[model samples]
Target: MIGFVVEAECMFYQDKPIHFECTACGKCCTGNAETHYIALTPTEAAKLRKHLEVSEAWFRRRYVEHLTRDSWGIRMHNGQCAFLDKHGRCGIYALRPTQCRTYPFWPELMDDEAHWQAEKKYCEGINRGQVVDIKVIERKLKQQAAAEEHA
Candidate 1:
């Protein structure tokens, strides 16, 4: 027998061609704050205020939760997102935070097939629709990371 060394591409490459398409299930928005907390920057909060046509004080008082003396996140109501409408849809889908926009494509969920499938319990869109391109996933990840950096 002969010995040889070989390298494989990233482990995730093996799980390629993953499929996802948001069906607006809203399960992700309805969870304990720890698992579903959506952090927000001051600027993101301001945008949301403008979108809802609410005053700064009302927006902060109604929709913001202070995680720390200086940090804040979207307020959770009855263990669900404040913006999740009664119909299980995002009320501000057009103005949702980066965290909300890049959903199941998060780095944690895309870790491997197991994570992806595990999350399927909450989000029916996983592996159920169009095949998500790896590059698009990468881009979304980067965009989310950047936004979270300010959160």
Candidate 2:
């Protein structure tokens, strides 16, 4: 019998640097009905609520949904992030979840150049502006994993 296997190139191990700089075009913040949701940690929720000067109960009622007993995601309305403004900016930019903070450079996207190329279609910041070192990218990945662990 024959079997097929696919191995993705590891950008982290290969240490290929990539350039990125947010243009604030807000494409990443918007999604269609089929694919728009942002998971949030308890820490992220608290931070957002504090920024908005709202109570925890109010925050949950307005912006959060329980994905599972241990997982929570931001609400999506009208096929986009609930916190996205009409001006194409994040309404809660300062307190956006780690997932949002780490864009284009998400571990999965960074796994291979092909993934990064595909992502460039949506994110203008990809392969542009400052050349981010692989070490910085690795640190961001660890931070994302840590954030997910805590959440």
Candidate 3:
């Protein structure tokens, strides 16, 4: 027998033809008993403020809750995102944070096959939908990582 070594193209995403698409089921937005705060960044806050035509002070008071010195997360109401409407639609869908924009393809999730598969239980868009290229996934992950770095 001959021995050969091969390297994986991407250490994070092992599955081929990476696929994902948001089904807009809103499960991600619904916080559980364990707390599902959406970590918000200054940039995200500003965007949301402008979208809602609210002052920084007003927005922070109404939508954001300080989590720590280095970061802030969304305030949940009845164990669900405050921005999530009664119909389970994001009130600020267009202005959702980077973390919400990148769900199942998260770095930690992508780093492990089991992690990725486990997400399918809640996120219907995980294993189905359009075949996302690895490059796009990497870009989203990189952007998310950068945003989280500030969080």
Best TM-score goes to which candidate? 1
Ranking by lDDT: 1, 2, 3
For residue 125, model 2's alpha carbon misses the true position, in angstroms, by 1.2
lDDT, model 2, position 12 = 42
Per-residue alpha-carbon lDDT of candidate 1 for residues 19-59, written as tens digits (9 for 90 to 100): 88888788888888876688778888999999889999999
Candidate 2 accuracy as lDDT = 0.77
2 against 3, candidate with superior lDDT:
2
Q: Pairs clashing in candidate 2?
A: none
Q: Candidate 3 on 1-151: residue-level lDDT in tens?
A: 0110122245546466667878788999875735567889888888888988988888888888888777888877787888998789999988888888877657678766778888888788887878888777777777777676667
lDDT against the true structure, each candidate:
0.78, 0.77, 0.76
TM-score, candidate number 3: 0.85
Question: Looking at model 2, which ten-residue stretch has the lowest summed lDDT?
Answer: 1-10
Q: After superposing candidate 2, which stretches have Cα over 4 Å from the reference?
A: 1-9, 12-15
